[model samples]
Each structure stands twice: as structure tokens, then as C-alpha cells.
Target: MKTIFFSFLFFGSLISAQNSLSFQAQLPSINLWTKIPDGPGPGGENIVSAKGSVTHVSIPKLIIHQPENPNGIAVLVISGGGYAHIESGSEGYPASEWLKSLGITAFELQYRLPEEGWATRSVPFQDAQRALRIIRKAAGKYKIDPNKIGVLGFSAGGHLAGYISSTFNTAYYKPQDDIDLISAQPNFTAMIYPVVSMLPPNNTTHSFKSLLGKDSDEKDQAKLSVEKQVNAQTPVTFLAQSEDDPISPVENSILMYQALKDHKIPAELHLFQSGGHGWGMGKKGTNTGEWTDLFLKWLKVNGIYNSDQ
Candidate 1:
């Protein structure tokens, strides 16, 4: 296993003290694509959204969110933008805050979009694996337990969390550094309104198309449809989605839950009536508002809640 050593400042540190600590690096073995452009995001209140979301990703950024009392648990947070843009505001910063409140550190991952002339589908996954290696390798310095590293993904990011958890053994790129020697498997995963399948008849077309390309063959599509990829080794999972999610169907979570059960992996699923798709944490009067509550309960059961700290 390649062991790459690096450091990033903890979140909440003074701006002057932390600026130099930000860690943004390209994945190991970025062979051909050297130059990438940084495009503007669809700016909003506290959120950054890249219009069309297909811009090239030069480097993956890991923005840390450190907890006041570290309990050895950490989460790699991934935001969704339908494979085009990243929902950093809605999913990244807010997610880190929540995770911190639970005494768990969070690293917001700014991953590559497939449209940037990358593999069109594989770049995101490859980057994700690399991100896992970086976080796990630096866990000790970050006051985290390498074994407690988990993934929490929103929407398209959710699909990535599931995919990486299920397929960490498959090598998409050659080893780059010492970090490559570490396992990329997340100890646990939480997928929110994720895209579980890439195959036709149940696929989130826009996401799949952006990922696999419109001209890609069905066989390739089937290979990435994560629900079918689950094996006995997939980690325990937590999933939540509204039944009325207009974009990705609720069936995505259902199919995944069933697969986990078949494999005898610990799993939990929550479906809400309101909070249409992409609501993040739901607004007032939505049953989905309690999704995190359910998640924390499950986490406690699985010994990930970190109440001892």
C-alpha cells in the first residue's frame, strides 16, 4: 500500500492560521489530463453551484471540519450536482457542521465532473478512491481513527459512496503513492437520495449520461449500476429519500436496501412523504426532517455515534 503523508489544518482554526493548511491535490496517476480549468459556480446564499456542472476538475479539494472533542470518527462528505456541478453549499459546509456537532470530523470532497474530458464516468470514482486513501492515511494526524472513516454522500454523491463501498477492490488506476497501499473501503456509508442504478428502465438518465456518456454501451452502464455490484463485503449502510422525489426515484433506496439484506449487511432505509428531491435537510413540516435522527440512532447501534467522547 502506498503511504502518502500530508497535512491540512483543522476546521474552525483562525483564517490566518488555517489558510496554509488547506489540502487540495490531484489523484495519484493523473497520467494524461494535466491542465484543468476552474469555472465559476452558480453562487447562492452560502452555497456554490457550477452552472452545467461539467467543468474539468484540476484537483480534488478536502475541506476539513474539525470537532471540538474528537472521538476518533471521521466522515468524507461528498456533494451532488447530477454529475455536472457540486452542491457544495447545500451538502458540503452544512454537512460538515452537522458532523462536527456529533463529535465527528468531516472532510468535504470537491470531486471531478465527468464532462471535463475525463473518462466521462470513471474519473469521479477514481477520485473518490484516492480521496479515501488520503483521509485514511492522514487519520492519525487529524485525530481520527482510520478504521472509523465513513462516507456520507448526497444525491449523485450518494451513488458514489455506495459505488466505492462496493467496488473498492477494483483498481481503476495504478498506485501513485504510499496512500495507495491503504484500503479505500469506507467503514460505513450514508447515502441520501442517491442514484443507485445506471441501467435503462430505472436509470437517472441525466446523471448516467453525464457519467457514462450518451454513446456508452449498455454493458458498460450495467457495470456501474451500484445496486447490482453489492457483495457480501459491502459495509453497513444508511439511506434516506422522500417518496415524492421527482428526480431520482425512491426505488433507488429500496433496491439498495434489499440488496444489503440479501448480503446480510446491516442496513437502514427511511422514506418520507414530503421534502421533494434535493431538499438536503428538509424544511419545516416534513417527515424527512428526522432522517438524521434515524441515522444517528443507527450509528449509535453500530458503535459509530461516539457518545463516549
Candidate 2:
């Protein structure tokens, strides 16, 4: 019996290694759809006619940098391109590589967009939830610790990540296969220039309307604003934004941080005076790029970086 167990373990390890190698090779070729466009935008007061989709899909590219020592920390990275496209190079790859260098496994999620239907809010959210479950289901194979999983997103992706963190308990779609058994809650979240407010004062951020749909009325708006839904159970969040960001204002992160604090959830807000929006990983010598270092330190202070556990 002992010999059979040992043989199984050895074979499993070999198989996992082979699979990882194959995945690495194929990562470059994986073309995941950000969203399938529905038609033109929904022109109206406060609502802008933007590209949208019905069935948004995500293709996660897993990169393992520090393969020798797995830190148990896994980050699901979401890139920002409003709700129209995904900035893969600037936001996705660079951010993932940074996490990988820190011994943390990274999964770059190319979530669905809002170009399909105006009334559909479930697509992108569902994709995020599915991605989390898929990662957790294959945690052992990926050499990732299931409990230490977290999420990071930029711009619209930031909203997606925040939504996932808040709505882990809300089931929008049926589970697929056994992977559905895992919870979708992100242990922690890091949002960069996220769009947290969608109502009147933040009408300029049409990304929310594009995602949720044009018909998303006041009630729906109230429901989707993650800042309003934050609770004690909300994951610890680290947020950063520039004051001069034209796409997403600094108030977005500020509102989220305030909500988190109100709920007594551990939260950190780093508002840089410069570094206008969409500077993924930031340019060299810029304050935005410095956010990564600050995030790492915050993680350490919060005890999330402890590898011993």
C-alpha cells in the first residue's frame, strides 16, 4: 500500500510538471475574447452609447516566475481598457510578471466586456467568478495555495475585481462541473484607478453603464456600486489612484477606502499627486510605478506575505 501511494505521488508530480510546461508554451497563443459587441451605444442623459457584449469570456494566462519557491500567494490580474478592450501589454503582462518575481503565482484574466447586451451585468462578473473557481480547483496542480488567493485589476478591471470581492456570496450563474464547489471570494484585492461610483456624481464613468447595460436604472446602480455594498466580510483592499486621472477620478478609490473603513475592513489608500490614469505599472521613475512597492509593503504589514503559513 505504501509503495502504491509513493508511486502515485511521483507520477502525479511528473504529470503536473508536463502540464505546466505545455501551458507555458501555449500561453502566448491563447486568444481570449474580452467581449462580443452588441451594437452601438445607448445614447441618453448620463448614459453614453458605448460598445457592449452579451457573453464575455476570459482566457487566463498563468505565468510562474519564481518556480523554485511557491509563496502560496496567487493573484488574478485584470487589465483595463474601459469595457471596450483589454490593455494586455501595459496592464496584464507587466503586472503579472511583477507578482511572479515576488514568488507569487499570477493568472492574467481577460474578462468579458459589455458589448453584447445593454441589460446584461452578469457576463463579466460571471467570468471573474468562474476564473477564481477554476484557479482554486486546480490549485494543487498549479502549486498554488488555495487560501491565499487574491485579485488585482486596473480601470474597469478594477471594478470587476471589486465586484468579485463583494459579490462572492451572490450567485449570478449556475456552477459548471466540480469546479463550482470552490468559493469565489478573493482573500485580498488591489485595485488601480478603479470605477467604484456609477451614479449621478460619477456619470462620466460610463464604464459601469457599458458593463451593466443602459437600462440599468437607479436601483440597479445602487446595487452595483461596490462601495455601497462593502461589509465586514469584504476582503482587505489596497487601492491607488492619481488625482488628475481623466478616465477615472481619484474619488473612486477614496469612496471605496472610506466604505472599507466604515465596515472595519482593513484597507489602504495611496493617492499619488501625479501619475494620471492608465499608467499600468507606471513609467520609470514615476510615482505610479512606485505603487507596486507600496502594495508589497502593505501586504507584508498585513501578514499576507508570511510564507510560513
Q: Considering every candidate listed, which one attains the maximal TM-score?
A: 1
lDDT of 1 by residue, 127-204 (tens): 788888888888888788888999999899999999999999889677766778889999999999998888767665
Per-model TM against the reference: 0.82, 0.79
Off by over 4 Å in 2: 1-68, 117-119, 307-309
Sliding window of 10 residues with minimal summed lDDT for model 2: 45-54
Clashes of each: 11, 13
Candidate 1: deviation at residue 92, Å? Answer: 1.7
Q: On a 0 to 100 scale, what is the lDDT of residue 308 in model 2?
A: 51
